[model samples]
Target: MPSMRTRPSRIVLIALLVVAALVLVAVVAVSAPILLHRSAGGSGQEIPASAVPETTARGADGRVRTLSAHDGDGPADLGAVAPGETLRIDGSGFDAGIGIYVAVCAIPASSEEKPGPCLGGIPEGAESGTVDESRLTSAWVTNDWAWRSFATHQYSDASEGSFSVTLTMPEPASTGLDCRETRCAIATRADHTAGSDRVQDMLLPAVYE
Candidate 1:
Protein backbone atom coordinates (compact mmCIF):
# COMPACT_ATOMS: atom_id res chain seq x y z
CA MET A 1 0.00 0.00 0.00
CA PRO A 2 3.08 2.34 -0.18
CA SER A 3 3.66 4.92 -2.94
CA MET A 4 5.85 3.86 -5.92
CA ARG A 5 8.58 6.42 -5.06
CA THR A 6 8.78 5.15 -1.41
CA ARG A 7 8.73 1.49 -2.57
CA PRO A 8 11.95 1.98 -4.58
CA SER A 9 13.58 3.83 -1.65
CA ARG A 10 12.75 0.98 0.72
CA ILE A 11 14.21 -1.59 -1.65
CA VAL A 12 17.51 0.40 -1.87
CA LEU A 13 17.60 0.70 1.92
CA ILE A 14 17.11 -3.01 2.35
CA ALA A 15 19.88 -3.80 -0.16
CA LEU A 16 22.28 -1.44 1.70
CA LEU A 17 21.47 -3.11 5.01
CA VAL A 18 22.20 -6.53 3.54
CA VAL A 19 25.57 -5.34 2.22
CA ALA A 20 26.46 -3.85 5.61
CA ALA A 21 25.70 -7.08 7.39
CA LEU A 22 27.84 -9.04 4.94
CA VAL A 23 30.76 -6.62 5.46
CA LEU A 24 30.55 -6.95 9.20
CA VAL A 25 30.65 -10.75 9.01
CA ALA A 26 33.66 -10.65 6.70
CA VAL A 27 35.52 -8.35 9.11
CA VAL A 28 34.93 -10.65 12.07
CA ALA A 29 35.96 -13.70 10.10
CA VAL A 30 39.21 -12.03 9.03
CA SER A 31 39.99 -10.89 12.55
CA ALA A 32 39.18 -14.12 14.31
CA PRO A 33 42.57 -15.64 13.40
CA ILE A 34 44.48 -12.66 14.73
CA LEU A 35 42.54 -12.77 17.96
CA LEU A 36 43.23 -16.47 18.33
CA HIS A 37 46.97 -15.98 17.75
CA ARG A 38 47.18 -13.30 20.41
CA SER A 39 45.29 -15.50 22.81
CA ALA A 40 47.58 -18.46 22.26
CA GLY A 41 51.00 -16.73 22.25
CA GLY A 42 50.21 -13.81 24.55
CA SER A 43 50.92 -10.22 23.53
CA GLY A 44 54.63 -10.45 24.34
CA GLN A 45 54.89 -10.60 28.11
CA GLU A 46 56.86 -7.91 29.90
CA ILE A 47 60.18 -9.07 31.31
CA PRO A 48 60.21 -8.18 34.97
CA ALA A 49 63.36 -6.41 36.19
CA SER A 50 65.07 -9.52 37.60
CA ALA A 51 62.60 -12.31 37.33
CA VAL A 52 63.41 -14.98 34.75
CA PRO A 53 60.65 -16.92 33.03
CA GLU A 54 59.47 -20.14 34.73
CA THR A 55 60.64 -22.45 31.94
CA THR A 56 63.65 -22.28 29.64
CA ALA A 57 62.36 -19.36 27.69
CA ARG A 58 63.42 -16.72 25.19
CA GLY A 59 61.42 -14.25 27.23
CA ALA A 60 61.64 -10.67 25.94
CA ASP A 61 65.42 -10.66 25.72
CA GLY A 62 65.47 -12.27 22.24
CA ARG A 63 66.26 -15.66 20.77
CA VAL A 64 66.88 -18.42 23.31
CA ARG A 65 70.60 -18.65 23.99
CA THR A 66 72.39 -21.71 25.22
CA LEU A 67 73.19 -21.50 28.97
CA SER A 68 76.35 -23.46 29.46
CA ALA A 69 78.29 -23.92 32.75
CA HIS A 70 82.00 -24.47 32.39
CA ASP A 71 85.32 -23.61 34.00
CA GLY A 72 86.68 -22.62 30.58
CA ASP A 73 88.12 -26.08 29.87
CA GLY A 74 86.07 -26.81 26.76
CA PRO A 75 82.54 -26.55 28.27
CA ALA A 76 81.24 -28.47 31.31
CA ASP A 77 80.23 -31.37 28.99
CA LEU A 78 77.64 -32.09 31.69
CA GLY A 79 80.26 -34.06 33.54
CA ALA A 80 82.53 -33.68 36.57
CA VAL A 81 83.22 -29.95 36.85
CA ALA A 82 86.73 -28.75 37.44
CA PRO A 83 87.40 -27.08 40.80
CA GLY A 84 88.69 -23.53 41.47
CA GLU A 85 87.51 -22.29 38.08
CA THR A 86 85.39 -19.29 37.24
CA LEU A 87 82.01 -20.12 35.63
CA ARG A 88 81.06 -18.11 32.56
CA ILE A 89 77.39 -17.81 31.59
CA ASP A 90 76.83 -16.65 28.03
CA GLY A 91 73.25 -16.44 26.79
CA SER A 92 70.27 -14.23 26.06
CA GLY A 93 67.18 -13.12 28.10
CA PHE A 94 69.32 -12.59 31.21
CA ASP A 95 68.26 -9.41 32.98
CA ALA A 96 70.96 -6.89 33.71
CA GLY A 97 72.01 -6.45 37.35
CA ILE A 98 74.76 -7.32 39.80
CA GLY A 99 72.93 -10.35 41.18
CA ILE A 100 73.51 -12.77 38.28
CA TYR A 101 74.02 -16.30 39.63
CA VAL A 102 75.10 -19.84 38.81
CA ALA A 103 73.60 -22.58 40.98
CA VAL A 104 75.22 -26.03 40.90
CA CYS A 105 74.24 -29.48 42.17
CA ALA A 106 75.85 -32.90 42.12
CA ILE A 107 73.89 -35.17 39.77
CA PRO A 108 73.33 -38.73 40.88
CA ALA A 109 76.49 -40.69 40.06
CA SER A 110 74.17 -43.25 38.60
CA SER A 111 73.38 -43.11 34.83
CA GLU A 112 70.81 -40.33 35.13
CA GLU A 113 71.09 -37.38 32.74
CA LYS A 114 71.69 -33.79 33.79
CA PRO A 115 68.67 -32.14 35.41
CA GLY A 116 67.19 -35.61 35.95
CA PRO A 117 66.77 -37.84 39.01
CA CYS A 118 68.31 -36.26 42.14
CA LEU A 119 69.17 -33.07 40.24
CA GLY A 120 66.24 -30.69 39.76
CA GLY A 121 65.98 -27.29 38.09
CA ILE A 122 67.59 -24.35 39.88
CA PRO A 123 65.84 -21.05 40.53
CA GLU A 124 63.33 -23.76 41.31
CA GLY A 125 59.92 -22.32 42.10
CA ALA A 126 57.02 -20.44 40.60
CA GLU A 127 59.20 -17.33 40.91
CA SER A 128 62.91 -16.95 40.34
CA GLY A 129 64.66 -18.08 43.55
CA THR A 130 66.53 -20.94 45.20
CA VAL A 131 65.25 -24.48 44.88
CA ASP A 132 62.23 -25.33 47.04
CA GLU A 133 63.66 -25.98 50.52
CA SER A 134 61.12 -28.61 51.49
CA ARG A 135 61.94 -30.53 48.29
CA LEU A 136 65.74 -30.22 48.60
CA THR A 137 66.25 -31.79 52.01
CA SER A 138 68.63 -34.45 50.64
CA ALA A 139 70.03 -33.08 47.37
CA TRP A 140 73.53 -31.61 47.49
CA VAL A 141 73.09 -27.84 47.28
CA THR A 142 75.25 -24.73 47.48
CA ASN A 143 75.78 -22.47 50.47
CA ASP A 144 74.88 -19.46 48.34
CA TRP A 145 73.88 -19.46 44.69
CA ALA A 146 75.11 -15.90 44.35
CA TRP A 147 78.80 -16.12 45.15
CA ARG A 148 81.07 -14.12 42.85
CA SER A 149 78.97 -11.91 40.58
CA PHE A 150 81.12 -10.37 37.83
CA ALA A 151 78.48 -8.65 35.70
CA THR A 152 79.78 -5.23 34.69
CA HIS A 153 77.69 -5.15 31.54
CA GLN A 154 73.98 -4.38 31.68
CA TYR A 155 71.38 -6.39 29.80
CA SER A 156 70.39 -3.17 28.10
CA ASP A 157 73.80 -3.23 26.44
CA ALA A 158 72.48 -5.94 24.17
CA SER A 159 70.71 -3.72 21.67
CA GLU A 160 70.22 -6.88 19.64
CA GLY A 161 68.33 -8.48 22.53
CA SER A 162 71.11 -10.62 23.96
CA PHE A 163 72.87 -10.62 27.34
CA SER A 164 75.57 -12.48 29.28
CA VAL A 165 76.84 -12.80 32.86
CA THR A 166 79.57 -14.70 34.63
CA LEU A 167 79.87 -16.01 38.19
CA THR A 168 82.61 -17.88 39.96
CA MET A 169 81.57 -21.54 40.14
CA PRO A 170 80.83 -22.71 43.68
CA GLU A 171 83.63 -24.59 45.31
CA PRO A 172 83.43 -27.94 47.13
CA ALA A 173 83.25 -26.12 50.44
CA SER A 174 80.62 -23.80 48.97
CA THR A 175 78.17 -26.64 48.35
CA GLY A 176 78.59 -27.58 52.07
CA LEU A 177 79.94 -30.88 50.75
CA ASP A 178 82.85 -32.41 48.83
CA CYS A 179 81.12 -31.96 45.48
CA ARG A 180 84.11 -30.25 43.85
CA GLU A 181 85.29 -33.60 42.48
CA THR A 182 81.90 -34.61 41.11
CA ARG A 183 79.68 -34.26 38.07
CA CYS A 184 77.02 -31.57 38.52
CA ALA A 185 74.06 -29.76 37.05
CA ILE A 186 74.21 -25.98 36.71
CA ALA A 187 71.27 -23.56 36.62
CA THR A 188 71.55 -19.81 36.09
CA ARG A 189 69.60 -17.14 38.00
CA ALA A 190 69.60 -13.41 38.77
CA ASP A 191 68.92 -11.12 41.74
CA HIS A 192 65.89 -9.44 40.08
CA THR A 193 65.95 -6.60 42.62
CA ALA A 194 62.74 -5.69 40.88
CA GLY A 195 61.34 -8.83 42.52
CA SER A 196 61.60 -10.08 46.13
CA ASP A 197 64.84 -10.00 48.14
CA ARG A 198 63.64 -13.00 50.13
CA VAL A 199 64.42 -15.08 47.05
CA GLN A 200 68.06 -13.99 47.29
CA ASP A 201 68.53 -15.69 50.63
CA MET A 202 71.06 -18.52 50.15
CA LEU A 203 71.34 -20.69 53.26
CA LEU A 204 71.88 -24.34 54.15
CA PRO A 205 69.23 -26.91 55.03
CA ALA A 206 68.87 -28.85 58.37
CA VAL A 207 71.86 -26.67 59.38
CA TYR A 208 71.70 -22.96 60.04
CA GLU A 209 74.57 -20.81 58.85
Candidate 2:
Protein backbone atom coordinates (compact mmCIF):
# COMPACT_ATOMS: atom_id res chain seq x y z
CA MET A 1 0.00 0.00 0.00
CA PRO A 2 2.99 2.34 0.19
CA SER A 3 3.67 4.80 -2.63
CA MET A 4 7.03 4.97 -4.46
CA ARG A 5 8.18 8.08 -2.53
CA THR A 6 7.39 6.46 0.86
CA ARG A 7 8.98 3.18 -0.18
CA PRO A 8 12.34 4.86 -0.90
CA SER A 9 12.31 6.70 2.44
CA ARG A 10 11.52 3.43 4.29
CA ILE A 11 14.41 1.69 2.56
CA VAL A 12 16.79 4.49 3.48
CA LEU A 13 15.62 4.38 7.10
CA ILE A 14 16.15 0.62 7.26
CA ALA A 15 19.63 1.00 5.79
CA LEU A 16 20.52 3.61 8.39
CA LEU A 17 19.24 1.35 11.16
CA VAL A 18 21.35 -1.54 9.91
CA VAL A 19 24.43 0.61 9.77
CA ALA A 20 23.80 1.76 13.33
CA ALA A 21 23.42 -1.80 14.51
CA LEU A 22 26.67 -2.85 12.88
CA VAL A 23 28.52 0.03 14.47
CA LEU A 24 27.15 -0.97 17.85
CA VAL A 25 28.28 -4.52 17.36
CA ALA A 26 31.76 -3.39 16.48
CA VAL A 27 31.94 -1.21 19.56
CA VAL A 28 30.78 -4.05 21.78
CA ALA A 29 33.31 -6.46 20.34
CA VAL A 30 36.15 -4.06 20.98
CA SER A 31 35.00 -3.10 24.45
CA ALA A 32 34.12 -6.55 25.77
CA PRO A 33 37.69 -7.75 26.30
CA ILE A 34 38.79 -4.56 28.04
CA LEU A 35 35.78 -4.76 30.31
CA LEU A 36 36.53 -8.34 31.16
CA HIS A 37 40.10 -7.44 32.05
CA ARG A 38 39.02 -4.61 34.29
CA SER A 39 36.63 -6.87 36.13
CA ALA A 40 39.36 -9.42 36.83
CA GLY A 41 40.61 -7.25 39.75
CA GLY A 42 44.19 -6.38 40.89
CA SER A 43 44.91 -2.87 39.67
CA GLY A 44 46.32 -0.27 42.06
CA GLN A 45 46.22 -2.45 45.14
CA GLU A 46 49.44 -2.74 47.16
CA ILE A 47 51.39 -5.96 46.76
CA PRO A 48 51.27 -8.23 49.81
CA ALA A 49 54.67 -8.71 51.46
CA SER A 50 57.57 -6.89 53.02
CA ALA A 51 60.54 -8.01 50.97
CA VAL A 52 60.88 -9.05 47.32
CA PRO A 53 63.83 -9.96 45.16
CA GLU A 54 65.17 -7.79 42.35
CA THR A 55 66.43 -9.10 39.03
CA THR A 56 68.81 -7.14 36.85
CA ALA A 57 69.83 -7.12 33.18
CA ARG A 58 72.57 -5.25 31.41
CA GLY A 59 71.84 -3.65 28.05
CA ALA A 60 74.22 -3.58 25.10
CA ASP A 61 75.07 0.01 26.01
CA GLY A 62 76.36 -1.08 29.42
CA ARG A 63 73.34 0.40 31.13
CA VAL A 64 71.64 -1.82 33.72
CA ARG A 65 67.91 -2.43 34.18
CA THR A 66 65.97 -4.07 37.00
CA LEU A 67 62.53 -5.62 37.65
CA SER A 68 60.93 -6.38 41.00
CA ALA A 69 57.63 -8.06 41.79
CA HIS A 70 55.12 -7.38 44.55
CA ASP A 71 51.91 -9.04 45.63
CA GLY A 72 48.97 -7.06 47.03
CA ASP A 73 50.63 -6.45 50.37
CA GLY A 74 54.36 -6.03 49.71
CA PRO A 75 57.38 -7.42 47.93
CA ALA A 76 57.01 -10.98 46.56
CA ASP A 77 59.31 -13.60 45.08
CA LEU A 78 59.18 -14.02 41.33
CA GLY A 79 59.62 -17.77 41.74
CA ALA A 80 56.44 -18.16 43.79
CA VAL A 81 53.58 -16.21 42.23
CA ALA A 82 50.09 -17.61 42.58
CA PRO A 83 48.09 -18.21 39.42
CA GLY A 84 45.44 -15.52 38.82
CA GLU A 85 46.90 -13.32 41.55
CA THR A 86 47.93 -9.74 40.92
CA LEU A 87 51.52 -8.54 40.91
CA ARG A 88 53.17 -5.16 40.79
CA ILE A 89 56.38 -4.92 38.81
CA ASP A 90 58.88 -2.13 39.29
CA GLY A 91 61.59 -1.13 36.85
CA SER A 92 64.58 1.15 36.94
CA GLY A 93 67.72 2.28 35.01
CA PHE A 94 66.11 1.91 31.56
CA ASP A 95 66.66 4.09 28.54
CA ALA A 96 64.10 6.86 28.53
CA GLY A 97 64.54 7.70 24.84
CA ILE A 98 63.31 4.30 23.73
CA GLY A 99 59.90 2.69 24.21
CA ILE A 100 59.49 -0.67 25.89
CA TYR A 101 56.90 -3.38 26.54
CA VAL A 102 56.58 -5.10 29.92
CA ALA A 103 54.86 -8.45 29.86
CA VAL A 104 54.71 -12.00 31.24
CA CYS A 105 56.07 -14.48 28.74
CA ALA A 106 57.51 -17.98 28.41
CA ILE A 107 61.22 -18.28 28.99
CA PRO A 108 63.18 -18.67 25.80
CA ALA A 109 65.32 -21.75 25.16
CA SER A 110 68.37 -19.50 25.20
CA SER A 111 69.30 -15.89 25.90
CA GLU A 112 69.49 -15.14 22.17
CA GLU A 113 65.87 -16.16 21.68
CA LYS A 114 63.14 -13.54 22.02
CA PRO A 115 60.44 -13.67 24.66
CA GLY A 116 56.80 -14.41 23.85
CA PRO A 117 53.87 -15.11 23.28
CA CYS A 118 53.09 -12.93 26.25
CA LEU A 119 50.06 -13.30 28.47
CA GLY A 120 47.15 -10.79 28.19
CA GLY A 121 48.43 -9.68 24.76
CA ILE A 122 48.60 -5.91 24.15
CA PRO A 123 46.03 -3.62 25.65
CA GLU A 124 43.52 -1.92 23.29
CA GLY A 125 43.53 1.15 25.52
CA ALA A 126 47.21 1.70 24.69
CA GLU A 127 46.15 2.86 21.23
CA SER A 128 43.92 5.43 22.85
CA GLY A 129 44.85 7.82 25.67
CA THR A 130 42.68 6.03 28.20
CA VAL A 131 44.09 3.09 30.17
CA ASP A 132 42.09 1.05 32.69
CA GLU A 133 44.45 0.30 35.56
CA SER A 134 42.45 -2.68 36.74
CA ARG A 135 43.05 -4.33 33.36
CA LEU A 136 46.75 -3.67 33.05
CA THR A 137 48.30 -7.01 32.16
CA SER A 138 50.93 -5.65 29.79
CA ALA A 139 52.17 -2.09 29.61
CA TRP A 140 53.97 0.09 27.08
CA VAL A 141 56.37 2.75 28.33
CA THR A 142 57.84 5.47 26.20
CA ASN A 143 58.40 9.15 25.74
CA ASP A 144 57.83 9.03 21.99
CA TRP A 145 55.46 11.30 20.16
CA ALA A 146 52.73 8.67 19.86
CA TRP A 147 52.95 7.91 23.54
CA ARG A 148 52.97 11.54 24.53
CA SER A 149 50.03 12.25 22.28
CA PHE A 150 47.99 9.17 23.14
CA ALA A 151 49.12 7.12 26.14
CA THR A 152 50.94 9.78 28.13
CA HIS A 153 48.54 9.48 31.00
CA GLN A 154 48.68 5.72 31.27
CA TYR A 155 52.31 4.98 32.22
CA SER A 156 55.57 6.88 32.30
CA ASP A 157 58.86 7.13 34.08
CA ALA A 158 61.10 9.60 35.80
CA SER A 159 63.89 11.25 33.80
CA GLU A 160 65.91 8.18 34.77
CA GLY A 161 63.47 5.86 32.93
CA SER A 162 62.38 4.09 36.07
CA PHE A 163 58.75 2.93 36.04
CA SER A 164 56.30 0.62 37.75
CA VAL A 165 53.18 -1.30 36.68
CA THR A 166 50.83 -4.01 37.92
CA LEU A 167 49.45 -7.06 36.16
CA THR A 168 47.31 -10.11 36.88
CA MET A 169 48.90 -13.55 36.60
CA PRO A 170 47.53 -15.43 33.61
CA GLU A 171 46.65 -19.09 33.91
CA PRO A 172 49.22 -21.52 32.57
CA ALA A 173 46.79 -22.62 29.87
CA SER A 174 46.37 -19.06 28.64
CA THR A 175 50.11 -18.78 28.01
CA GLY A 176 50.12 -22.08 26.06
CA LEU A 177 52.97 -23.04 28.40
CA ASP A 178 52.46 -24.81 31.66
CA CYS A 179 54.35 -22.47 33.96
CA ARG A 180 53.90 -25.00 36.74
CA GLU A 181 55.87 -27.47 34.68
CA THR A 182 58.16 -25.05 32.85
CA ARG A 183 59.71 -21.72 33.76
CA CYS A 184 58.16 -18.41 32.79
CA ALA A 185 59.30 -14.83 33.31
CA ILE A 186 58.27 -11.25 33.67
CA ALA A 187 60.08 -9.54 30.85
CA THR A 188 60.75 -6.26 29.08
CA ARG A 189 61.65 -5.64 25.47
CA ALA A 190 61.59 -2.90 22.92
CA ASP A 191 58.08 -2.03 21.86
CA HIS A 192 56.80 -2.45 18.30
CA THR A 193 58.28 0.94 17.53
CA ALA A 194 61.68 -0.65 17.91
CA GLY A 195 60.80 -4.33 17.63
CA SER A 196 64.25 -5.63 16.77
CA ASP A 197 66.09 -3.67 19.41
CA ARG A 198 67.38 -5.88 22.21
CA VAL A 199 69.08 -3.24 24.28
CA GLN A 200 66.06 -3.09 26.53
CA ASP A 201 65.45 -6.79 26.77
CA MET A 202 65.39 -8.21 30.29
CA LEU A 203 63.81 -11.09 32.16
CA LEU A 204 62.89 -11.87 35.74
CA PRO A 205 62.33 -15.61 36.02
CA ALA A 206 59.04 -16.75 37.48
CA VAL A 207 57.09 -19.86 38.41
CA TYR A 208 53.42 -20.21 39.32
CA GLU A 209 51.92 -22.75 41.66
Candidate 3:
Protein backbone atom coordinates (compact mmCIF):
# COMPACT_ATOMS: atom_id res chain seq x y z
CA MET A 1 0.00 0.00 0.00
CA PRO A 2 1.30 3.50 -0.87
CA SER A 3 1.68 5.85 2.09
CA MET A 4 -0.93 8.66 2.06
CA ARG A 5 0.58 12.11 1.74
CA THR A 6 -0.83 15.71 1.80
CA ARG A 7 -1.66 16.86 -1.72
CA PRO A 8 -0.76 20.33 -3.15
CA SER A 9 -4.41 20.82 -4.12
CA ARG A 10 -5.53 20.15 -0.51
CA ILE A 11 -3.00 22.71 0.81
CA VAL A 12 -4.26 25.38 -1.59
CA LEU A 13 -7.86 24.69 -0.63
CA ILE A 14 -7.06 25.20 3.03
CA ALA A 15 -5.41 28.61 2.27
CA LEU A 16 -8.49 29.71 0.29
CA LEU A 17 -10.81 28.81 3.14
CA VAL A 18 -8.70 30.84 5.58
CA VAL A 19 -8.85 33.87 3.28
CA ALA A 20 -12.64 33.61 2.92
CA ALA A 21 -13.10 33.51 6.69
CA LEU A 22 -10.94 36.61 7.12
CA VAL A 23 -12.98 38.46 4.48
CA LEU A 24 -16.23 37.73 6.26
CA VAL A 25 -14.84 38.94 9.58
CA ALA A 26 -13.62 42.16 7.95
CA VAL A 27 -17.03 42.81 6.36
CA VAL A 28 -18.80 42.44 9.68
CA ALA A 29 -16.37 44.74 11.44
CA VAL A 30 -16.76 47.44 8.79
CA SER A 31 -20.56 47.39 8.84
CA ALA A 32 -20.86 47.50 12.63
CA PRO A 33 -20.34 51.25 13.01
CA ILE A 34 -22.84 52.07 10.32
CA LEU A 35 -25.40 49.78 11.85
CA LEU A 36 -24.89 51.38 15.22
CA HIS A 37 -25.24 54.87 13.80
CA ARG A 38 -28.53 54.09 12.16
CA SER A 39 -29.88 52.45 15.27
CA ALA A 40 -28.70 55.29 17.48
CA GLY A 41 -30.38 57.96 15.36
CA GLY A 42 -32.76 60.64 16.74
CA SER A 43 -31.13 61.91 19.94
CA GLY A 44 -30.40 58.35 21.07
CA GLN A 45 -33.37 58.27 23.45
CA GLU A 46 -36.80 56.72 23.34
CA ILE A 47 -39.80 58.91 24.16
CA PRO A 48 -43.53 58.41 23.91
CA ALA A 49 -45.20 59.12 20.59
CA SER A 50 -46.87 62.22 21.98
CA ALA A 51 -44.03 63.26 24.21
CA VAL A 52 -42.84 66.81 23.61
CA PRO A 53 -39.53 67.98 24.99
CA GLU A 54 -39.57 71.19 27.03
CA THR A 55 -37.45 73.63 28.99
CA THR A 56 -38.33 75.34 32.23
CA ALA A 57 -37.56 78.77 33.60
CA ARG A 58 -38.73 81.15 36.34
CA GLY A 59 -39.29 84.81 35.61
CA ALA A 60 -38.30 87.51 38.07
CA ASP A 61 -42.00 88.14 38.58
CA GLY A 62 -42.32 84.68 40.17
CA ARG A 63 -44.16 83.19 37.19
CA VAL A 64 -42.98 79.94 35.61
CA ARG A 65 -43.00 79.11 31.92
CA THR A 66 -42.65 75.76 30.24
CA LEU A 67 -42.06 75.95 26.50
CA SER A 68 -42.78 73.37 23.78
CA ALA A 69 -44.15 73.16 20.24
CA HIS A 70 -44.62 70.95 17.21
CA ASP A 71 -43.91 71.22 13.45
CA GLY A 72 -46.71 73.49 12.30
CA ASP A 73 -48.83 74.85 15.14
CA GLY A 74 -47.62 77.55 17.43
CA PRO A 75 -46.45 76.37 20.81
CA ALA A 76 -49.19 74.60 22.72
CA ASP A 77 -50.60 76.11 25.89
CA LEU A 78 -48.41 74.02 28.11
CA GLY A 79 -49.97 75.55 31.19
CA ALA A 80 -53.22 73.89 30.25
CA VAL A 81 -51.71 70.45 30.01
CA ALA A 82 -52.62 68.01 32.75
CA PRO A 83 -49.97 65.69 34.06
CA GLY A 84 -51.13 62.80 31.87
CA GLU A 85 -52.67 64.70 29.00
CA THR A 86 -51.63 65.32 25.37
CA LEU A 87 -52.02 68.67 23.63
CA ARG A 88 -53.10 68.75 19.99
CA ILE A 89 -52.51 71.80 17.82
CA ASP A 90 -53.66 72.71 14.31
CA GLY A 91 -52.22 75.44 12.10
CA SER A 92 -50.27 76.33 8.93
CA GLY A 93 -47.09 78.25 8.23
CA PHE A 94 -44.17 78.75 5.80
CA ASP A 95 -42.21 75.83 7.18
CA ALA A 96 -45.03 73.48 6.31
CA GLY A 97 -42.62 71.65 4.11
CA ILE A 98 -39.63 71.39 6.42
CA GLY A 99 -41.49 71.71 9.80
CA ILE A 100 -41.77 74.19 12.64
CA TYR A 101 -39.46 74.97 15.53
CA VAL A 102 -41.11 75.19 18.94
CA ALA A 103 -39.70 76.77 22.09
CA VAL A 104 -41.22 77.34 25.53
CA CYS A 105 -39.55 79.84 27.81
CA ALA A 106 -40.30 82.41 30.41
CA ILE A 107 -40.14 85.87 28.95
CA PRO A 108 -37.62 87.70 31.04
CA ALA A 109 -38.86 90.62 33.07
CA SER A 110 -39.21 93.89 31.18
CA SER A 111 -36.73 95.36 33.59
CA GLU A 112 -34.15 92.80 32.48
CA GLU A 113 -34.36 94.30 28.98
CA LYS A 114 -34.47 90.80 27.47
CA PRO A 115 -34.55 90.35 23.71
CA GLY A 116 -35.88 88.11 20.98
CA PRO A 117 -35.64 84.37 21.20
CA CYS A 118 -36.57 84.91 24.80
CA LEU A 119 -37.77 81.35 24.73
CA GLY A 120 -34.92 80.30 26.99
CA GLY A 121 -32.70 81.78 29.68
CA ILE A 122 -29.83 83.93 28.57
CA PRO A 123 -26.47 82.29 28.63
CA GLU A 124 -23.90 83.41 31.19
CA GLY A 125 -21.39 85.93 29.92
CA ALA A 126 -23.13 86.05 26.58
CA GLU A 127 -24.26 89.03 24.57
CA SER A 128 -27.55 90.26 25.98
CA GLY A 129 -29.79 92.10 23.55
CA THR A 130 -33.35 93.28 23.16
CA VAL A 131 -36.37 92.55 21.00
CA ASP A 132 -38.17 95.76 20.28
CA GLU A 133 -41.65 94.90 19.11
CA SER A 134 -41.98 98.51 18.12
CA ARG A 135 -38.92 98.64 15.85
CA LEU A 136 -38.95 94.90 15.09
CA THR A 137 -35.44 94.47 16.45
CA SER A 138 -34.94 90.97 17.88
CA ALA A 139 -31.99 89.65 19.82
CA TRP A 140 -31.43 86.10 21.00
CA VAL A 141 -29.17 86.07 24.05
CA THR A 142 -26.90 83.09 23.57
CA ASN A 143 -25.71 81.03 26.56
CA ASP A 144 -28.61 82.24 28.65
CA TRP A 145 -31.42 79.96 27.53
CA ALA A 146 -32.09 76.67 25.88
CA TRP A 147 -33.86 76.68 22.51
CA ARG A 148 -34.97 73.70 20.50
CA SER A 149 -34.64 71.68 23.65
CA PHE A 150 -36.85 69.21 21.90
CA ALA A 151 -37.29 68.55 18.21
CA THR A 152 -40.58 69.55 16.66
CA HIS A 153 -42.75 66.71 15.45
CA GLN A 154 -41.74 66.77 11.75
CA TYR A 155 -44.66 64.99 10.15
CA SER A 156 -46.12 68.02 8.37
CA ASP A 157 -46.44 67.42 4.64
CA ALA A 158 -47.44 69.68 1.78
CA SER A 159 -51.01 70.96 1.31
CA GLU A 160 -50.76 72.53 4.80
CA GLY A 161 -52.51 70.48 7.44
CA SER A 162 -52.70 70.35 11.21
CA PHE A 163 -50.13 68.61 13.43
CA SER A 164 -50.27 67.37 17.01
CA VAL A 165 -47.56 67.49 19.71
CA THR A 166 -47.56 66.13 23.23
CA LEU A 167 -45.44 67.04 26.23
CA THR A 168 -45.39 65.33 29.61
CA MET A 169 -44.94 68.12 32.10
CA PRO A 170 -44.11 67.45 35.69
CA GLU A 171 -47.09 67.21 37.97
CA PRO A 172 -47.95 70.43 39.74
CA ALA A 173 -48.26 69.03 43.22
CA SER A 174 -49.21 72.40 44.78
CA THR A 175 -49.05 74.86 41.98
CA GLY A 176 -45.37 74.08 41.46
CA LEU A 177 -44.97 76.49 38.55
CA ASP A 178 -47.36 79.29 37.79
CA CYS A 179 -47.89 78.42 34.12
CA ARG A 180 -50.10 81.50 34.09
CA GLU A 181 -48.87 84.09 31.62
CA THR A 182 -46.58 81.44 30.13
CA ARG A 183 -46.15 82.04 26.43
CA CYS A 184 -45.43 79.59 23.68
CA ALA A 185 -43.53 80.69 20.57
CA ILE A 186 -43.74 78.70 17.35
CA ALA A 187 -41.43 79.75 14.49
CA THR A 188 -41.13 78.31 11.06
CA ARG A 189 -38.11 78.70 8.81
CA ALA A 190 -40.08 78.91 5.62
CA ASP A 191 -39.12 77.27 2.40
CA HIS A 192 -38.58 79.69 -0.52
CA THR A 193 -41.37 78.19 -2.57
CA ALA A 194 -42.87 81.49 -3.58
CA GLY A 195 -40.31 84.29 -3.14
CA SER A 196 -39.15 85.36 0.30
CA ASP A 197 -37.89 83.23 3.14
CA ARG A 198 -40.87 84.35 5.14
CA VAL A 199 -40.64 82.94 8.65
CA GLN A 200 -43.87 83.10 10.58
CA ASP A 201 -44.21 83.20 14.36
CA MET A 202 -47.29 82.95 16.51
CA LEU A 203 -47.44 83.44 20.22
CA LEU A 204 -50.10 81.54 22.17
CA PRO A 205 -50.51 83.21 25.52
CA ALA A 206 -51.42 81.11 28.52
CA VAL A 207 -55.08 80.29 28.82
CA TYR A 208 -55.30 82.12 32.07
CA GLU A 209 -53.72 85.17 30.53
Better of 2 and 3 by TM-score: 2
Q: Over the full model, what C-alpha lDDT does candidate 2 score relative to the true structure?
A: 0.66
| lDDT (10s digit) by residue, model 2, range 79-134 | 67766688888888777766678887776665555677777677666667677767
Model 1, 55-163: lDDT tens digits are 2344333334334433466553333333434445444443332233334544332221122111222333424344343332122212212321222333434433344
Q: Using lDDT as the measure, what is the rank order of every candidate, best first? A: 2, 1, 3
- Location of the lowest summed lDDT over 10 successive residues in candidate 1: 200-209
TM-score of each: 0.33, 0.67, 0.29
By descending TM-score, how would the candidates be arranged? 2, 1, 3
Better of 1 and 2 by lDDT: 2
lDDT of 3 by residue, 1-209 (tens): 43355576777999999999999988776454334422111111111123243433332323232333432255454434444333433443222332233323233233222212333232222233322212111112111012222222333433333343433332322232343444323222221121122122333332222
Give the backbone clash total of model 2.
11
**Model 1 misplacement above 4 A:** 1-65, 70-73, 95-99, 103-153, 165-167, 175-184, 195-209
- Indicate the TM-score of model 1: 0.33
TM-score between model 3 and native = 0.29
RMSD of 1: 17.7
Best-fitting candidate, measured by TM-score? 2
Q: How does candidate 2 fare on TM-score?
A: 0.67
